[model samples]
Target chain A: MTRIGRRGAGLMAAAGLVAVVGVTVVRPQFSAAEAERPAQVSVDEVEELERAEQILIQRCIERAGFQYMIVPRFVDPVPFTFSYVVDDAGWADKHGYGAALRRRAEAKVDPNERYFRSLPPTRQEALATALNGPEPVGLTATLPGGQVVQHSDKGCQSEAQRELYGDLPTWYASTKVIQNLKGHRFGMVLGDPRYQAALPAWSECMRDRGYRFTSPDAARSEKLTQVVELRQAGAEARCAISTGLGALVRELDTSYDAQLREEHQSLLATRVDLQRRALPKARAL
Target chain B: MRFMKKAVAAGAILVAAMGGAVVSPTSASAAVTAPPPDGHLYAWLDINAGEYYHCRWVGNDDNWTNCTDWDGVARNMHDRASSVQNRGYTKEVNLYNDAGQRGAWRCLSRGEFWPDLRNVRFNRGSSETGYNYPMENRISSHLWVSSC
Candidate 1:
């Protein structure tokens, strides 16, 4: 596990400047400069980072005298809906619940899996070891729940992450903590009185539009014909906007996310710092 | 070849089906089941996929409290899995530490098998802070995702 060196600290200071600039231009509410303010990392940047890691993995495995396939990460055709309700009428009209897109995605076979299966037994075993490093024993992380998880620090995969992210242990811990925060944030948003108070209006709006659903999730989960599903989804999205459900959910979700970020500021800072530093390296790859 | 730690002990049971050679517990456990091909994710009651006590699922399951094992007998898999295997065709399998997919979790890539989950751990859960726990015998739910 690599410690955050002086170079890393310098990079973090630069990242802090960027965030401060963002706050100054975007949200004037906080006149004080918050060095730990979270920067919104774009999806494209994340994809680039993933592609870079795959490249590094491919190189590492090949150096170990094994053939490694660089599988491109799957990109969802439909955008993710983070809010409890779907607010984009256009998106709903085009892809109701994105069932068809999901099916299409499922049908798309992964080349990596196919290649691995085609290898002879001995070669397959060797390749697996090369890629994964035999066991999960080198790097350890204690999660927010206090569960200690470990990953192989010797694998080509681990090397690739270390190459880009700097410290594998810190990267693993911070990323896991950030990802798991979603569940709690979702639960908080669901239980919020403001969210609950707005739900009835959204439900009533949908009801008036010939749909009987108490929540957007209920509406989305109901099975219907393609044509009906499209129409219902359109109505749901419209109702979400009309009743202010979508906006409210988004606001609450963001608020909670910010609060969580504050609570785990140091971890978030480290993760964002690493990512920012890796961006140039990812682009170069 | 790096043989799975438990393959030696389970080799006798799998030899007939796997041609007297067991490379990994994934192939060993898979040899026990007939037909339906090998695309389902499996969870075992004992480490190294202990003798005939396992359940398989091809899709997402929110709860495994009363699921049937390989022998067609009813078994509770929730929070009772000591090992796991992902024989999935493409997707990665996510094993959650809590039911209803609400807790700490980890992803097992395609063809990856954990013969002994005692070495694994659920990264963390938002609400349950500061509690160190092993992943062994504590998986409550699962889902197949595109990536880890």
Candidate 2:
């Protein structure tokens, strides 16, 4: 692949993908909005629930006779949907996987961690109890493969969870599989022949732009110089789109999501009901 | 390795991709299962008696035994329980330290695996606010509650 120059910029703009001006890399609309999908709990929904949890935890801590400061929710420069797959060339061009977000998140929590550490062990235990309940107590389930996990209904932690998702243990089991399935989905995508086939092209696109990274993750490493990092990331993002990795994986994800929904239609129904009930309660926080 | 106070959901067999940069797990067929029977909130005591780990399930039988079951022929071991893992499919269970269900109670939410019973510290006072004390092995009686 020839090094992309003004020709590449003009070509991308002509295709309605991006517009590059000097050092500026333009982005297309986020693809998650490209389709109107069935309603499941969105990342925004989960984030809201989490923020409510933090508030409740803070309150619980205060009730335990210690002052607890609320930490800001860790913000990612990229949308939650985009985090799983760097399928957005525009996002990558502007922010290489938003690696700085990790540091930002850490900085946000440092004070909270410090304050927590300052408490005496007894106070610490009290705070933990107030927040988590009397350690985990509740249900133990065994899966067919000898893998067992437990869910606890104890503590303010569970209380906060219950506020968002009714029927806490059931909700947890149902919603939890969604996360597990997703991890599996990603693994599947990486293994698919088409995605594997496209990687070399993505790597070539990055290489043509003077970056020698073999993968987008490598090009997006935060350790690199900010200027060089963004440049490489931008190049990889454009390449990812040009190679059609974004659209391909998006299709795969949608398909898998549908299959899982069908397989667990019963659980999904409860999940939808719980999340709908939860949204308003979370907002009330 | 740091003590992950957080109970890890039984570890997934992780599949690494792109030279291990992108990591994801193959969906285990076992991740889904039918709900437990007896319909009562189920709680498990995780015991590591020396090198081996043992899990004991309690509170599902018609006459589930606990410290409060004074009329029972046998009492479920109390305080010997090291940690609790709750598998209550739908409801929350409360674990108590004092007999007759009248004392400090801990609510175990559903689908949560807490690796340690000694995880909570509370102050031993007369009311909601008190001095801090650890709650490991002190559970005696418990009741299912509406919420934790």
Candidate 3:
């Protein structure tokens, strides 16, 4: 072989070696960077919570006296109609730690502010819908019993509905559904109208746990303590409802989450083009 | 051998006259360009986020299992990545969650870009076949994200 041919072969090999080394080093770096970047929104849980909250809130709103909207993520609503009702009924409120709304309402908050103030969470949606919108309502009038009643002009439920669903008389309903496909048992219930209804009686129960209504018979107090006991029972029932809902919700979306997971993995499996526009700007640090 | 030498000499002369270029610059550049890594962004499933937690709780009786406590989620994710890498694929993974006091989970993967990839999944720790932790202790979608 000529000397030039051997030299040419050696030079070619050296160039190939440099190219391979450079490519190997550069490729992994790019791949690694691409691999680490995360998606903008991981929102499956948020969506699910919102769905569940919507269901419960709708159910609660449809009932007569609970004539109030949930303050998503807020501890309680301003002027707290529920609290005022409880205070008027004179039941002591109590809640576990966390947001201020977790506390029970004592004093009669102004009917106008009732829609705006914080109070104990009964339907238990304050945490779930926190990210969405704020509370929407205002107070109207003070009742003769010192309870501040939200006025009809304020767009709350009418007096008759409140009477039927609230202080007057109310019935609780519970529904149980066993998922056919997944064999999961879930239950939803309106155990206590106070938790589910905006009834003045329910609110009055919140204030004085032992407060009672004097029947026109005048000698007999309609034992408001029964309402407190009812509330405690309702809390227990709601807990069960939450658990059942959890199982059923999981079953309903199994394939969907699976698909999302697959889509995510596929995204991880392919090559990415880091366009100049998409590249992150280098931080000064 | 003499004919081969003559042919080689002729090729060399032609190459020298043509600036010794064996391939067009465009073709050479194209041949050397390495494929980019998959850049599709994937965020780690934020269990705190409503969608992920709801998916995990959909059917199983236990509503209280927390995805964050399940470190196996991360391990499973890494293992899945190994399978893909073994199959001659490229990727990146990351962890993410909503704003809260609890530390974010590490098992989920997020990517920047991806193409020709279809699906990737891993066990997120909760199982229909097995018992999960206590429900009373379990975090719910109704709980504040920060509490997680």
- Largest DockQ belongs to which candidate? 1
Off by over 4 Å in 1: A1-48, A69-71, A276-285, B1-42, B46-90, B94-143
> What is candidate 1's lDDT per residue for A92-186, written digit by digit as tens?
89877677777688677677666767877556656665666554445545445543433456667779989999888778668766866765577
| Tens-digit lDDT string for candidate 2 (B30-139) | 22121222222322344211111222333422222443211222446454445454443234566655554545445555445534345443212112221123456665
Point to the candidate with the largest lDDT: 1
* Model 3 stretches with alpha carbons more than 4 Å out: A1-21, A36-245, A250-285, B1-148
Computed on C-alphas against the true complex, the DockQ of each candidate is 0.09, 0.06, 0.01
Candidate number with the higher TM-score (2 or 3): 2
> How many clashing residue pairs, candidate 1?
3
* Candidate lDDT values, in order: 0.68, 0.50, 0.24
Residue-level lDDT of model 1, residues B1-148, one tens digit each, is 1223244445455656556454443343343322112456778887655455678876789998978754567878887888777655456877887777656677776545565677665543423321135788788888787866
Per-structure clash totals for the candidates: 3, 27, 69
The alpha-carbon lDDT assigned to residue B61 of candidate 3 equals 17
Give candidate 3's error at residue A15 in angstroms: 20
Ranked candidates, highest DockQ first: 1, 2, 3
For candidate 3, the chain B TM-score comes to: 0.16
Give, for candidate 2 chain A, the lowest lDDT window spanning 10 residues. A139-148
lDDT of 3 by residue, A105-166 (tens): 31323332253224333322231122111111121222111211111111112222232223
Candidate 2 i-RMS (Å)?
Answer: 17.9
- The alpha-carbon lDDT assigned to residue A196 of candidate 1 equals 79
RMSD of each: 11.0, 21.1, 31.6
